[model samples]
Target: MARTHTPRSHLSVLHTSASRFASSPAFYVPQTLSESGDVASWKPISYIQFLHDVELFARHWAHVLKLDGIPRRSVIGMWLSGMTYVDVLHIYGLSRAGYIPQLFSIRLPNPDVVYELLSRANACALLVDPSFEGLLKSCPIPTHRAATTVYDIDSHDMPLPSLPTLRERDTVFIFHTSGSTSGIPKLVPCSSSWLDSAITKSHQIAMPSGRTKRNQDVTVWMGSMCHIAQTFMLLGSLQHGACTVQPSRQAFSSNELSLMIRDCGVNRLNQFATFLAQHLRNSRQNPRLLALLQTLDDALYSGLALPREEEEWAHGNGIRLRNLFGSTECGAMLLSTRGPEMFLQPLDGMSYAFVPVASQSEAGTSQGGHSAPLLELVILAESPDCPDNSLRAADGHFHTGDLFQEIRTGCYLSKGRDDDWIKSENSLRCDTKAIEDNIRATCCDLVAECVVVGNGRPSPALFIETNSDLPQPKLKREVLRRTRQFHSRRYLHERIASADMIVIVEKGSLPRTATKGNVRRRVTEEAFRTVLDKIYGTEWTGTT
Candidate 1:
């Protein structure tokens, strides 16, 4: 029998993208933003050219590498810029040769973190970008620790080599989750089929038809190549026949972004909610800038939810705002545009076989501050490829620590993470989501984001990221007042440590998911350890 199209396989993506959209451009960086991170006229790279490059890379993998015919699939650790053509080809070519290509973040300049990742991955060979030279220098271990080695493909003296055949199930991408849990990385093994499924679904759901190079969802891939967002942007652009707006090495500023969108005829954005909010606030000062955003059809974000007013702002401006919900573990429980029911429905011949929801207790207080219990997500089979899918429980389902509620039968809404639950200083259980949600509802006008801290402390304290540029006293008062109100009424049993426990911080101060843009509670709590201690210590009870 002939090979039938399987679940989101990239084995065919290469052929289809190159053949079906042969004339279309695969990668585009405007002349204003060039390789040097300066204004320089450069031609776009077409799908054909991209494929030829992939061929070269594949050949390099087959013959040039010392570990060409290794027993196991070699893991090639990649350190490259976001959404670069080389990054795509490196991954595509490596996948073809049965090598797992894992990307490291360019923004993480810290040598220790980079080394820790490399050591953990045990990348047999590294394909590093020239810019990451400092990373090479900082390798405390013997550069070739154990059997590990390096291959600077850019400067390698080797010529073109033959390419090897790839098995559809040959690739399993290794992803390191954001240090959301105690600053330790969670290594996730997501197979190519799983990735292909995500990319295809994302392309099918997110990419609108009739998109041209000038009026396409020309996303400036802000997330690092390591992120799932990068996978969507890179491959989704290819499938959609759209152009990826590659800004300079640095992310586009509000002014620069506005100019780029206007001049480039851009149509989409994937950014942090806080970042977009700040830009919107900036736009108020320059009405012309705000007017420019009206051209976009959609803006996708992760991290903080956009305040209702901002959501209204997007709606009034004829833009669709989406807060994508999911984790590296669950492959996106919900997308912004689609209903939760649609997600659970089989997409492209792949289904995890969903199970019924059940009530699960955690260390934290219940749904209504120790009243109702949170419903646990018991996913039966998230993916066949992820053999290590621990989300699956002994009950033959992936019992997620995430709480959800079926609003009306099929439709569902995510409450928060049950795993983030912790005991408060006052002997009450608390979770970051409940605190953040309460703050957003009660004090939306006051803070950009209200992160609940003080895990294992006397009481939960608020790390307030104020929305305004104005003086702090009034905003502080507003937050304190709101906290008092929530404590008195909605969450009577779970009291928020007093006003003085609230610490006002600037925007972008807290850490967030690179892809989803969701705030990481554990990371944020750790970051404000001093403030947490203050809130839990002797001064906490006496705090003004």
Candidate 2:
């Protein structure tokens, strides 16, 4: 297929989803565990009430934005703590009033990064949640205020503020890049039509074959309102009349998660693969939850491919975990595979190819038959939801920043991120995926994550995390065992680097994307700079 700039657009999502599924149930929020630490009963908010909430919020939200000098189509920054039905309402209200909603995760500890996003978006004012009020005060920006929460779902007859007219092509959403690779944040603007398509695409790509039992199945949204993935999942559930399940603000204990699965009958989940791993592990501990998993319709995940072990675990447990590929800039998922298929050869309608980097010399592209040259994965699609202003190559293809090797017709295997490609002074290259894979497999039980760093050095260094309980002696021994195993691979040969340089960090010390669980490579390098300095005898300039 040839690349083309033209894409058919759709109507605004906010005003139409309810009418499209007028008979569907709205959303389901399990009350937070009470003071006594008991799970609360499930409550369902109807579409009627949802619309009323949107209307009420839009009218008043618009007034507040206007008073703060925010005009129609202004980008509004949101510092979100927890995702709720109200946050969903906030997006719709902002869109309805012609204010574009952009989210900055409160999970990120850096106030400077959050402030930079507000500055980049030229946000009129930052609307922060009450829980994030203290965090917002330090973020130097134009101005900030606490946004209204949806305390009551039942609509009151408060004088409705009139909604400003919005356009289908209007930029209604501005989501920041995960920035796990780079600690700094950049914005991805989403138009109303883009979200409109995402709402429908979520169904087409994610819905189980021949099943539309509206309000019967529930979809768990694991991302916060500020994260890009959450908005689509919320709207997608509402469109299908499927109940949207809210994850606990804090990580759910294995027992609590089990109860939610049993009680909520959560058959579908759209979240990072890491969270799913915890659920899968917990299900093994709880028979009822395992039974629930056995009957799951589908599980959609992004962030990174599930560790091969986790993917195998899902299949052995009788679950079909699918992979979703997209970025905030792509608007929504540009490519998705059904079930647990791991290969990413593009299906028809989307054209993908491996190409040499734009700056790579002609010598780099000249390859002998014995070995294949390293190339970047690029995509050319007719997705109208994405604006043309997004990062793109001069040729118009969206360079996904992923690396892959086309093994055969319509099949390709992932090689970590292109930025993770490492080249030593001797020109010997090592794949980050291979290292991470070995480390993960070796420390599968004790390690929560494994990051291979040393893009430009003689050998790679491993930064791993695990539960704080593991004795330092045991942790060191296990990591050393893994390091030995990693180097034992003759395929990597002498390219293998330092194993004794392993750093065992406490949990949560490594920077992670709030929703995606992706390790911020650059951020982690900087965060653990002191440790790396002590080990390497100088500053650690993290690999790109």
Candidate 3:
């Protein structure tokens, strides 16, 4: 029998390959309990079967909603968690049906924000998780019922159908920015072609071989499904015919994660740095992690900043940690495999370029200013024609709001956000990340996480979390000394003199969204109101 291969287009060649794989039993590895005490064993499905299921769900959705011949640009909202295979299938199905899937993160703070984002994005239908249906129903958005229709994916009991042909340039999914601490979540449309390009580029760059072979590697989904980085990793794995091991929605302990790592022989682990840091703290140096690391070929870290200590720890454990720099708007742009060497490399194959801001204009200042310190990303800027104009540039480069500095050869260190940098009394500017890094270097053993916030106030406040056993007075004194040591070299002693350390609640006390550590809201609500007032004997109220 002659094998059929779908033609690649601007939409997505990787998705087509994945669909083809799902049809045959050659790629099928049924779910089985491993000898190791892991919760769920790796279940590999045939690419053909996967495509068939996707087509069935697509047909069912189209028939139920009476949406016939809807154009490729039609938007469908997907409210799902990362744990289910259906989430990935739903995205592929939407692509097959020539519809753009708008994936909503389960970690979004509330339903109102979700509704607002959906309405703003002009979603035509919502494929919701049954568990979250109740919350969606309560959204106050009146026009939601009229403009958008709802489809319960969990409620469906249809059989798998034949797959449909899809174009590569057709948008497969839409990822919204996590508006946890920043502005409202904006839609970032991703074409099937983009996914294919990303996968091809990443594979070429990483050059996996031997046990790092496509089929043998185990990819774990650590971050939220809503995060683009994790989605990209998932798609990349599916394309390479790798086994994916994802944890359940229920609380996952570090011990359980270690078990899963060992049971699955997970070679490739992709996740947020914060999650890995937490895992490193919670899990002891067990045989499982050690065994997994022995066989581990590569690991990728992103989302939050990867601290030096954590990176060093991973390297010490014989794991190659690739620090990746990417955004929801522009897929995966940068991969730092050889640590800082990645920054010195040229912009090759869908990469990022730092555009120095020439001068500060009214419009530029409004949009975080284009100063020497601020590097405007020239790749994947929003279309100027669009009303919202979320994207900054159009010449294939987008102006990333993140601030960075070329510290030395091959190393470009990230400073704090342009908005978060605080100006001291002597007109000296202090980057919060720099301050946080200093604190971490000094109190690495005691502090789990730290966030520096300079609200519209005279001095920046350092919110530190220490070990429960550490005496408050000693910890405060140590923190002050560290802060002084950091500022002394910069000759900003008087400027930072007013800076104060506020001992926030213990680790895990702060609130967090799916992709971001939202310290602003948490500090204001929890630390300022409850703890700081009691400790300092003053009500510290400031807008963050």
Candidate 4:
């Protein structure tokens, strides 16, 4: 079949696809999860049915929310805590009704932050999943306690309204940052042009080199539906006539995910690094799960760096792990190709540049312990799909605040956040993310979490939360050995001098950001102030 010309806007593309593939399956919904976490059966939702549901919800919201005569592009807040296919449908439904759906993250547990974001977006109204209505008793906006489940029941026939005319620069969706590094999450508006580019670029890069076909028969999305990446992928997949499977429960177990992968015949998988690590660990004990994972055509991860040992293990076991790099501000930018180091392959239709970062240490050493200058990624404003101007700096480019190191010409490795660079008292700069990733990867089996501190102190200290049941003495010995192993190839100032510098805490004790559950390094450092004082109080002299 020859490809159809791409539509001018995101909703137009969906409208076209629904008309063309009316009977084709757009989603495979798990009917039920048995006690053992097995999927009993799958229910396919066709393109026409999905479009019909969207239309129904659009009309219903228009009536109940009194959206009649509302101005186009009015902001509407949506928080569907336990995400489902219905929530995704409502996003389109809201957009079709000439409103922008501003999504709130389920991972962000604090209602105050959500309220702040809602006020910041100037949302006209807020709609929440019925299950989470209790959370926002004091919400300032006009809160509507509703559920898409009402539309699930039988509905009277209604005439479909004409597609609203939307420009390329029109805001279609709104997402926010996790605020893992920054304090409060900021609203990121996605333009129609941005969504269109994402859909087109995703289809272009869907196929690998050796793959004979470009069809994504069944793709399982394992991340939060509120995540921008998942949202982009969902739109892209539907436009390409692919079937997607998502989790039914708020929190799905590994067994449930594995069952979905096996039963749904999933070829492509998109998951976070933490969940991937858990699956990898579980696969070690279950060969059947390992075999299922190896059968996947494409395995992708983002949000955080995958541990080195796990990446090696996946590739060794024939799982083609691909790293996806993108942000809420910018749609998908790069997809890593097969290589020794995960060198990024830039996607088409996006304009991005790298600005050189200053040398870190007195020796003029850059990040990654190499002479190559570390580069900060800048998303050029000239890109065809450039979204809103909120993040654009005075230079007319959105500085992503992400740092990368070039390993080869035109290929780079993501080093960590440029703002996360820590300077020790000896004037040597330490890459905190690098050290944390290394320690976590090296001692993955024993450590639940790791954070490096001591910004202006003698040396960086290692704080780890133990995940193992081994005795403290034995665990400390093993941890020290691994720490030494990690320090073997490092420069002098980057190493944690003695075993005394290693502080072990109880599991689940580290402070995490309310948004994405990422460890709040500054907050954690403050929480362990006494321990840090004790460690740094003594004459912790090291050769500098």
Candidate 5:
């Protein structure tokens, strides 16, 4: 059957870009770096070269599939790390060569979950980095399915074969949820039409005020490509004609990042909020990194929320930090470009609704001490903002588990996930994220990181991770004093009942997701089950 051609086909876009910007540098890879965090040497891959590389990979994979007798358009599961050009190239090349690429994080802790995802995706083959070839043996996949590493293909300048036509609804790429909340990742297939619409919207969406990255700006992605954010951002950069730089290492130190910024003339930084916070913390001692950050056009972050203190520090230091808001199921829909408070605005032409959540109170007291309405963001399925039909609910809208607080008529600030709400024994519910944010904002100096528990208990308990040498009692007193001051107006069920509920944990010891380092709330709660039990003295024994 003939497949309908979509205008947003990435292969077509790459062809157009290669012709339009043949000599333009598509990516800059760090070749060498000095001990003093100086870029000693680097290599730039031109757009023409990039297209040629894509074709080269496509041809190599095509020949491999021919030898293995795997049919075209078969789903191929990829487990590549290193965050190098190889990962990006493999994804693009597979799509161009008429195969669906299913991306998997190398950091997925369970081999069973990986096998299950692969099985669910009906993956006919596996492509992996050499380092991860052991995964093939670890998973009990069918022996008939072919498995190949990056080095298995021998490249030659054979003429590229005709690419297969892909239908609008055909799956081009497959992504997965963060699985931090769900405990197991869910597959999210990116359709051709959906991706096309996403790319088109990317061009229409306005960058945050005073924080836009120009087409000629140098951008660097600081996370795994397995993440849909990085992959989609790369496409957006391509559409915008921005030159991206791939760091020498998958995981680089703050000093190494500074060197990349210095040597690569990097104008935009795209990283997780946690890493950005870490850089800010490191910048306290290393003024050079801070200076380099101040010089950047914009620091784009997503994944987790940046700590309140670190966010303020960035703004005070003259760094423009923009937050990209979206998810694997829905793609990017919102961007925070206005100011340090990180209020999000929807993309141009994207229709969304902030349905007010039924809270116990008439209105919740927000961080600004104003009675703000709490709403859950919903993307109307009929709107252009809707990515795919996979996650659309029976109501015909994609209900993002994300909750936002209305700052104004159109602007909204993230208040964390809907599941982040804690229901007490009395049936009163409070936002765990809101309480934690308040405590962190007020007790920034006393608490490095914290989590609030007691989902079905009488009251919430606090867990703190701090670097201060103060005694546990004094630290609890100080934290409680500040938190109480911040939560004086908040409902009693929303506040920690007493100082005994504040448990001090070791710094950097919170359980976090492997990909973005977001603290797994449920996992963290489970880790301190005994301590929480002791604090509560008794379980509510009610359905959470």
Candidate 6:
């Protein structure tokens, strides 16, 4: 029998299918399932079978938590990794059952921190992957004493029943920000309507053609499922009925990813800049990638800035690399394709506004003592002025806290975060993004990622990850020389002299989240005090 394709104007075609299958058994397909003892693979599942699993899980969850009597909007926390398909199902099922699903990173430093976040969210139930069971057991929250219903996927013997239909406006998931620079990450509740909009917008911006709807075009993801970028891609692919290729437990090797790209026949590839850089560096000598490169249609880079040479290499290989700018708080914001103009175009159905940061403020705080500089984001509104604190030229636009400048006609280049700009003694200001761009342009093939941070210190510091296997001293000297050559001599002297130290690390040592690499966190934890002390022959507490 031929499957029917229903067209929708505002919603994605996949969302329509999901809604249509909510009550019908014929629509479910068991695409992902556990095979053998521990292995899992994608198998065809009927819409009815999938709904059965959802119902069973939802019923068990509600009964376990006594949610039968609780009101709607109750928070349920999900602390799991990306490998588990059940996590996706559980989230969707919970939303269908009228509960709010709070998604959190399992990378919390300690169990206490995890417990504190869940407790603060007032989560009524907690769904955990088996790997973190020990952490949960060690936490102060007693398993049997709390109102939370614990759903453990590893223990499949547990009882969980199914639930009925769900509402479109119901909150589906809640994501908390990483509190690296400020107070605790606040919970951002997401509704079905939001997901619908996000999925549609992402598909339009990413795939953008009926060709994407074809079965042969696979979507590749490298980041963790916890990160919104990965989440968006995973959900968007599933909704579009496109195949998704997930890397194994081992971090994606350049060889491995290159192979997967060819094997899966991936047409649309999305990943962080770091991942792409590492893959390119690793596959520099591999011959198979040339063929894989031929099959790839769109190569979308997000999470960080792509090195200029890497971008050129991809274009040289016939792949069009597009830059995606967005956050977990906001969905896809800006996209730039490979063209002579190379301007970032605002996504359709979404508008942006920006608020300028005060020049004197620091990176993680505003002049008013707020954590992080304040940039009002005006959503659904347009802006004519890019960085100035001018009055609203139009209504309905949000003022975004991110700093940006219109460098060319219709091209807005991102400066650093409002607080991340470094000011030299000569009163000259440097944007980290600009510095990163300069480093990429000068070093081209040597550098992977570079971060410039100035935190109420005398000199700004640059932390760089290099692709070459050169020793630390040689790499440091090379970086310093390049820095002097690329930047103005006076600017380099003022900045480098005021600069405390330059730290070089191997690729992949730096910490990265789903959206952006945490340069500050990596410096403080991995390089600064520990690595810098050994290199500089002193204890350092200069900057964050």
Residues 272-309, model 3: lDDT tens digits: 55555545544346656555554667666665455456
Point to the candidate with the largest lDDT.
5
Cα RMSD, each candidate: 12.4, 12.1, 13.3, 11.9, 12.1, 13.9
Model 5 misplacement above 4 A:
1-5, 33-40, 138-153, 156-158, 180-183, 204-215, 249-251, 360-363, 385-387, 420-544
Worst 10 residues of 6 by lDDT: 383-392
How high is the CA lDDT of each candidate model?
Answer: 0.56, 0.60, 0.53, 0.70, 0.71, 0.53
Q: Which regions in candidate 2 have their CA more than 4 angstroms from the true location?
A: 1-11, 32-39, 136-149, 152-169, 180-183, 211-215, 331-341, 345-352, 356-375, 381-390, 421-544
Query: Could you give me the TM-score of model 2 versus the true structure?
Result: 0.68
> Against the correct fold, how does model 6 do in TM-score?
0.61
User: What lDDT does model 3 reach?
Assistant: 0.53
Residue-wise C-alpha lDDT for candidate 6, range 1-544, written one tens digit per residue: 9964322211233345446554332211123334322213333334445555555566555555563355556877777664444555566556555577677655442455556667876776666665667656655432321112224422234554333233554545667543221213445555555665676666666453453455434666545455466667655555545555655432355555554555455577676665565556544576577567556666776655555676667667665677787666565677884653345667766546545456633334332344443343355432211211121234544344455555444455554454444432211234455556667888767788877654323345677788878777777677667776434322221244323377776677676665555555434444455655554453332322
Query: Model 3: what TM-score?
Result: 0.62
Provide the lDDT at 505 for model 4: 87
- Roughly what TM-score does model 5 have, to 2 decimal places? 0.73
lDDT of 4 by residue, 1-544 (tens): 9974433655676788899888888888778767766566778888898887788877766655553344556898888652567877777777776788898755555566678788888888888876677788788878776565634533334444457766667777888764322235568887777777777776665544345364446777654556576776776676677788866552356677677777776777776565566677778889988998887777887655665777888888988788887777776777787744678866776788878877543123333566766788887888755657887898888887777767666787776665665544422345678778767778899998988886545567888888899887787778778766555434344666587778888778889877778887767767777788688783212111
Candidates arranged by TM-score, highest first: 4, 5, 2, 1, 3, 6
Q: Give lDDT tens digits, candidate 1, residues 1-544.
A: 9975555545456667788767666666555554445434334677777777676666556454554334337666666654555566666766665567666555334455556666776766666666666557756433321111113343243444433344445446776554323323456666655665666566654566353434345665645566555665566666766666565543356766775676654677766554566566666687787777766666766543454566666666655566665455545445544311212222343344323344343234422344433456554454442334443457655655656544443444455555656433222235556667778988777778767765444456777777776577766676667666445422222446466667888887878888778777777876776666565553221101
lDDT of 3 at 460: 53
Candidate with more favorable, higher lDDT: 1 or 3:
1
TM-score of each: 0.64, 0.68, 0.62, 0.73, 0.73, 0.61
Better of 2 and 4 by TM-score: 4
Per-residue lDDT of candidate 5, residues 280-302 (tens digit): 88888998888999888878877
Residue 187's C-alpha lDDT in candidate 5?
A: 76
Q: Looking at model 3, which ten-residue stretch has the lowest summed lDDT?
A: 141-150
